[model samples]
Target chain A: MKTFLFILAGIISGILGGMGMGGGTLLIPMLTIFFTVPQNIAQSINLVAFIPMSIVVTIINIKGKMIEKKGLLKMIIPAIFTAVLASLAVGRTKNAVLQKSYGVFLIVTGVFFIALTTIKLVKKRKAEKENEK
Target chain B: MSKKKETILYIIIGLVAGFVNGIWGGGGGIFVVPLLVYLMKYEERKAHATAIVIILPLCIVSAITYILQGIYNFPLTIKVGLGVVGGGIVGAFLLKKLSNTVLSYIFYTVMVAAGLRILLM
Candidate 1:
């Protein structure tokens, strides 16, 4: 049962991760709430799980020639360094605070993405209407 | 933007996105894709692909840090990792068929649902 649950979690998060939205947003909550894992461990597991998904998706993307080489080159180094530093900081944060802060972050990001996408959709619709006319 | 200016912008996006990934685990792509598409003028598919690539190192470093701190659950992570590998392949293939609009709608719906659930419940 436990293994099954883990597989389920993996599949759910994997799809999101592969899609480039980060699987942890859903995986962390699923772990904490359903599986009763602690916040820190859940987050850690999410990171670990991301490794394989990232690798696979990256490989696929590479094969499909989907990446923007210039953007990848420009961002890779800075991204690594900042990730290392922030990860170290997370290692020291309290679980309760991390959980609350993570929740709030999700809410803000969710609303932001929803609003951005909605506006884009509306703009696209207007453009289509104009074209049709 | 000029080449030099664009490079700087990408760096900025990387720093912010990387920090978020490090702190949280799975949301770096949120910042990455948007910044790449809007700010850097990348195609949607290219942004998504590049974002995944950028996330790889971030996840690796963060996972290592968590391991060093002795916070990881190895068995669970490994199990899920196996599943995600297959899932990732599936999602990657799906990208060819899916439109950017469809993808964005899915992302918005999932993000909002997950956020509201976590925040309210």
Candidate 2:
């Protein structure tokens, strides 16, 4: 039963992630809240779980020639540097503190998405109205 | 943007996104996609594709760090990882048929609710 729940959580998060929504945000919380997984462990699982999915999609995207190569290295080099530093830092941070901070992050992300969606919806409606004339 | 400014912007974007992904274990792609689309002037599809490419390496590095830190559950990760891969395929198909705005509304609502629950816990 416990194993089933974990897989279910993964599937749910994966579906959203597959659609390019940030599934790890949902996955970590689900693990912590439903299964009582520790924040650090849950985070580790999320990072690892993302690996195969990303590899497959990335390969497909490359095959389709969807990736834009311009300036790619500029972004990748610094991102790799900081990601290593931050991952090490997270290893030392307290789990409770990490959990609370992640909560704040999720709320901010939710609000940001809501605002973006609302603006898009309004613009889409206006465009449709204009087209009717 | 000028060439120098664009280069600086890309680095800044990468640094922030990587930090967020490493600390939080994910969500960097969400941060990257919009920056690529709005600031970098990438088309939406290209931004999404590029964001994935950028995030893949970040996740790999972060995962390795976490494993080295001994923050890993092998059996659970395997089960969950397989399920996620299966669901991801389904999601890819759904993306073509669904109205993204409607999906976004639902997704964000759940996110806000989940956030509140976590905060209050």
Candidate 3:
């Protein structure tokens, strides 16, 4: 069942990841909730799990002609800076707290993403309406 | 070329993502994609690809840091690593058939739902 859950978690993370939402939201909790793994272990596992997903997405997108080289050049540094710090912190957390943290983070990120998306949608609708006039 | 701006943003995002990744284990892609697509005007695909590039370095750095700190678990990481490898292949192949717009709607929707579920549950 947990294997299935991990697979499901992988799928969910992959799909959401490809779509540009942060994939960690799906993955972190899935690791904790479904597998009953330790938090530190799960966090590392999440990264381990996500690494392949990120690479595959990169490779396929690159093949499909999705990668924008110029954009990549511009974004690489800042992205790495944060990723490194976050990875370190993940190492310190306990399993139980990590589990709850995953849940809490997911909830917060989910709400934030939705709210931001809605705002964008609303602004877009207003823009279109103005343009049509 | 806004070298300063790009560099500054890169550091800030990198610092933030790194700190987050230390604890969370995922988001270099998550946060970076938006930072690139929304803030840097990267197309969706480009932003994602860049996320990979960004993650690669952090992966190495973090792995090393954890090992040095005596917190790293190689045997376990290896197993999960194997899984991620396969998963990446699957995700890559799937990318060809899927539309980002459609994917985005689903992604955003799921995230929203996740948020709601978290709040309620």
Candidate 4:
């Protein structure tokens, strides 16, 4: 039963991720909250699980010429540096602190998305009004 | 944006996204997508695709770190990973057929609720 739940959680998160939504955000919360998995372990699971899933997508995207290569290295180099440092820091941090921080991150992400959606809607409405004038 | 300024901005985006993703184990793509779209003038679809390119390496690094730290559950990861791979294929198919506006709204609402729940847990 527990294993089933884990797979279900993975599938749901994966589906969202494959659709271009951030799956790890939801996956971590689901595992920690429902399954009582430790925060760190759940996070590790997300990182690992993302590997195979992303490889497949990245290959398809590359083949379709969907990826923008220009300026990519500039972003990737700095990101890789910081990511390494941060992952090391995770080992020394307390689980509770990480959990709380993640909670805050999720709220901020949610609000940000909602705001973006609202802005798009308002712009569309204004454009329609102008068109009808 | 001038070439130098644009380059600096890209580095900043990378720094922040990497930090967030590494600390949290994922979510760098969220930051990358928007920054690429609104700031760097990338089209939405291209930004999404490019984000995967950026995040793939980050996840690889972070996952390796976690494994080295002995924080991984191998069996659990494998089981969940299989599901994720299968679901990813389905999701890719769905992306072609479905409009994301409604889905986005629902997803955002759930994220907020889940965030609150996790905070109070």
lDDT of the candidates, in the order given: 0.79, 0.91, 0.61, 0.91
Better of 2 and 3 by DockQ: 2
The sequence of per-residue lDDT tens digits that candidate 2 reaches over residues A10-129 is 999999988888888899999999889899999999999999998888887799898999979999999999999999999899999999999999899999989988987899999999
Q: In order, what is each prediction's RMSD in angstroms?
A: 2.1, 0.9, 4.1, 1.2
> What would the per-residue lDDT of candidate 4 be over residues A89-113, giving only the tens digit for each residue?
9999999999999999999999999
Q: Which digits, one per residue and each the tens of the lDDT, describe model 4 over residues B34-112?
A: 9999999998888998998999999999899988998898898888898899888888778889988889989988898
Per-residue CA lDDT of candidate 2, range B25-49, in tens? 9999999998998899998878888
Per-residue lDDT over A103-132 for candidate 3, one digit per residue giving the tens place of the 0 to 100 score: 666656656666766776789889999999
Query: Which residue window of length 10 is worst by lDDT in model 3 chain B?
Result: B112-121
Q: Any runs in candidate 4 off by more than 4 Å, and if so which? A: A128-133
Better of 1 and 2 by TM-score: 2
- Which candidate number would show the highest TM-score if scored against the true structure? 2
DockQ of 2: 0.85
DockQ of each: 0.68, 0.85, 0.41, 0.86
TM-score: model 2 vs. ground truth: 0.98
Task: DockQ for candidate 4, please give it.
Answer: 0.86
Give lDDT: candidate 2, residue B92.
71
Q: Which scores better on lDDT, 2 or 3?
A: 2
Which sections of candidate 3 miss by over 4 Å?
A1-5, A18-20, A69-86, A123-133, B67-121
**What docking grade applies to model 1?**
medium
